[model samples]
Target chain A: SQTIHQWPATLVQPVGSPLSLECTVEGTSNPNLYWYRQAAGRGLQLLFYSVGIGQISSEVPQNLSASRPQDRQFILSSKKLLLSDSGFYLCAWSAIGDAAFFGQGTRLTVV
Target chain B: AQKVTQAQTEISVVEKEDVTLDCVYETRDTTYYLFWYKQPPSGELVFLIRRNSFDEQNEISGRYSWNFQKSTSSFNFTITASQVVDSAVYFCALSCSRVHTPLSPMDSSYKLIFGSGTRLLVRP
Candidate 1:
């Protein structure tokens, strides 16, 4: 079985502060990883995806960026957090022709 | 451009009743894929079903069934004898198949374009 873990399940920061959210997958290799954001009562919006280490694709360019430093590790970072950045962030991993396994998600609140 | 539309923004149903969620899509390419996912109250997504363009035959798994209409470009999902646990936000997704191609930057490997999602509430 595979499992995904995300740290700092919840965070609150003032506007213009820095942001970092970490995600890691275990029990799978060379899996497709994705980052998504969901606003309150809204559908998910794709932020970024990675096929391999150091290879990242930005679905919607904004104040956010993603990095895959290791095969199983993915990180979402921002130099300055904006009020619009507040949302529920999710990380997912999937194999070929298979379902994606999602993380518990990180709830970011920018004050 | 490819897009998915889940017209029903919210649905409320009583326990043990049947409910159907509607999804319509638009795409330029003829060959593509469709998917359904469930997001529970905990905010974790769970994959429910995947239907390729060639597969028009409907599928019934346990209490869930999917209707794929190629002519209309619609994929709908239904829950029979629904329970409280079935309450969740359902999303319809579209993907472009990358067949027999090496995984590369240009090769689009099942990239999902999701809909706005429909929220379902089952009351006991």
Candidate 2:
């Protein structure tokens, strides 16, 4: 079975502070990884996705960026966080022609 | 452009009542995929089901059921005898058969475009 782990489960960051949220997948190799953000009462918005290591695609222009440092390790980072950056961030993985599996998600609050 | 629409923003139903969440999608590709996901208040998304464009057969699993209608371009989900545990936001998504090429910076055909989600509140 495949599992995705994301942390810290919750985060509180000051405005303009640096942000780093890590996600890792187990039991699967070379899987497609994605970063999504869900604002309160909104749908999950795709922020970034990677097909392989060092291959990251940005779906929407924003204050966040994603990296695939390893085959199954993905990281979402920001040099300076903004108040708008607060949201529930989710990491997901999927194989071709399959539904995506999601992690527990990180609730980030930038105050 | 492929788009998914979940019409109901929120639905409140008493326990044991049958509830159906509607999903409508728009896509130009003949081959594509439709998916339904459940997100509890805990904020983790749970994959419920996936249906391809070629297969329109309805599926039933335990207390959950999915209806896929190609002619209507809709894939709806139903929860029979709902419980408080069924309270969550449900999202519908669509993806085309087109392969993603990193060279093309503007193409997201290979990615899933999610709907705004329908929040279901099942009271016991």
Candidate 3:
């Protein structure tokens, strides 16, 4: 059984502040990790995906960036947060030819 | 380029009634995959079903079933005797299969292209 942990489930920050959200998966090694953001009443948008340590693919250009410092650890960060960057962020992993498993998600609100 | 389209934005139905959510996708690849996921008020996306392009068989799992038609490029999900617990936003996604190229045993799975979701509301 694999489990994913995401921290600071909910956060509120003043505009122009920095942001960091961490996600870690246990029980699986070398799993495909992804970062997604969902705006209120909108669809999930793929932000970044990592194939391995130090290898990341960005799906869209935004104020966000992702890094895989370890095989099971993925971090989403931003040097300066924008009001538009606020949304519900999700981290997920999957094996080849398998369905993806998502974490609880982090709700970020930048005002 | 792959794209997923969920035609219905919102649907409301009474409890115990049957409901069907429609999904249409576009991809040029011969080998691709389609999936349906549920996101409840908890805000967690739950995997429902996955259909590979090679298999067109319709399947029934308990109160849930899926219909796949390659000709129409549609994959639809139906819930029989729907319950309030079934109320949630449903998403349709598409992914191209990793063909021939032997992937390392540790390669991360390919990414899924997602569609705008449909919110399903089951009322009592």
Per-candidate Cα RMSD to the true structure, in Å, reads 2.1, 1.7, 2.5
Screening candidate 1 with a backbone cut-off below 3 angstroms (N, C-alpha, C), the clashing residue pairs are: none
Distance from true position, residue A19, model 1, in Å? 1.1
lDDT of 3 by residue, A1-111 (tens): 999998879999988999999999999998888899999989999998877788788889988999999999999999999999999999998765568889999999999
Better of 1 and 3 by DockQ: 1
Of the pair 1 and 2, which is ahead by lDDT?
2
Return the TM-score for chain B, candidate 3. 0.90
DockQ of candidate 2 is 0.60
lDDT of 1 by residue, B1-124 (tens): 7889999999999999999999999887777788899999998888899888988999999999999999999999999999999999999988775553444663554566789999999999
Clashing pairs in 3: none
Writing each residue's lDDT as its tens digit, candidate 1 over A1-111 gives: 799998789999999999999999999998888899999899989898877788888889799999999999999999999999999999988775566778989999999
Q: Between prediction 1 and prediction 3, which has the larger TM-score? A: 3
**Cα deviation in Å at residue A81, candidate 1?**
0.5
State the TM-score of the second chain for every model: 0.90, 0.93, 0.90
Full ranking by TM-score: 2, 3, 1
Task: Give residue B93's error in model 3 in angstroms.
Answer: 1.3
Fnat per model, in the order given?
0.47, 0.60, 0.64
Model 1 accuracy (lDDT, Cα): 0.89
